[model samples]
Target: MSTTRLFNVYCDESCHLQHDGVPVMAWGAVYCQATETRAIAQAVRALKTQHGLSPAFEVKWTKVSPAKAAFYLALVDMFLADHRLRFRGLVVPDKGVLDHDRFDQSHDDWYYKMYYTMLRPIFCAPHRYRIYLDVKDTRGGPKTRKLHEVLANSLYDFDRKCIERVQQVRSHESELLPIADILIGALTYSNRGLASNSAKRAIVARLGERLGSTALTRTSTFATTKFNILLWQSREALG
Candidate 1:
């Protein structure tokens, strides 16, 4: 009998376009046991109601503002305080430096590779995972299918048992996806060296304080399961 544990991974990305005018790109996911998702989502809705926002109100990084700074901070607090939740983020400090031609790959190819790198650490034997990515564009369907194939092939899970599913979903539909948005937003903002939005800056500072770190731009130790971050550097940058 297989006593495999099920986990749901909600993924989000920030400034991922090759020429988005933003140098830093980040990908993040917030995952929890499959059984806990319903409860966690309910809790999030309850927080929204307590904060005087409509239950249907979408929690988003772009929605973070001075008026709702307190609510956003509370959201961060809630996420960190919850033992069942964990985060993993991968940051690319400068996408402009990437040489896809030299690597003999397209940007889309590298994009999938980055997703795999961001998610590889979360997979373990005997544990099944269902990945949910926020729909980015019209290509969402194809991207999801390709990503599923890539992840499964990389893990040698050809039967797709360990990597159960990879699907595209609207961020507004899932309570957890917004959490990933904010986390990824903070990483990209910090790495881009932006401070124009005080509200966003406050949230970033709160994350640092909660994690006992002065800066979010730095990478966290790989073993830091609670809120792991990887500042990815390309070979050229490494050299």
Candidate 2:
């Protein structure tokens, strides 16, 4: 008689490569009740159509431009207004400062660790989750398996009842993945102190305004459930 609720989590990352030239790296996830996934995605497609864009059009942060600002902003507003959806982001302000040698771990090991840290808070007992990560590269399959193992082990869910599965997915195939990209992109942009793209800047500002924060550069309080952000500081930075 376990009345466990099932949830679907869509995850995305921005500039997570070890030597990607981008100093800031961010990972974000947008999750909702399993039953609502289809309706939410259809609503997003409807908004695209209302904005005169094709329903097949992908909503992406990189594609945001002055011409599509209204559409993108409306998308953000829609996400905020919907109580069913929730976002959590983890920002690594500076990857260059990481000392892998000292930690006795490779960059990939740390990468998975960061993913675990970002996701650990979202898991609660008596609730099951299926996580979908946007495929990043050729290692997507192996990464997914490793992440699944890590999460399941960490949670002591050896039977895989709580953490049901972690799978790789194409961002274009999932309506919710792009939303994660948008939020992660904003965190990365803000942390990198970039101002080259006016459209992106506006989106970041609007997100902060909607969240009642002056900036997205800072870590949101732990109590923030709607759009939670964790500005992760390395041991070196903390020292």
C-alpha RMSD by candidate, in order: 1.3, 1.3
Tell me how many residue pairs clash in candidate 1.
0
Q: What TM-score, computed on C-alpha atoms, does each candidate reach? A: 0.97, 0.97
Against the true structure, candidate 1 has what lDDT?
Answer: 0.92
Candidate 1 C-alpha lDDT tens digits along 54-154: 98998999999999988899899999999999999999998888999999999999999999999999998899999999998998999999999999999
lDDT of each: 0.92, 0.90
lDDT of 2 by residue, 66-160 (tens): 99989998999899999999999899988889999998999999989999999988998899999999988898999999999999998999999
- Stretches off by above 4 angstroms in model 2 are none
Model 1 TM:
0.97
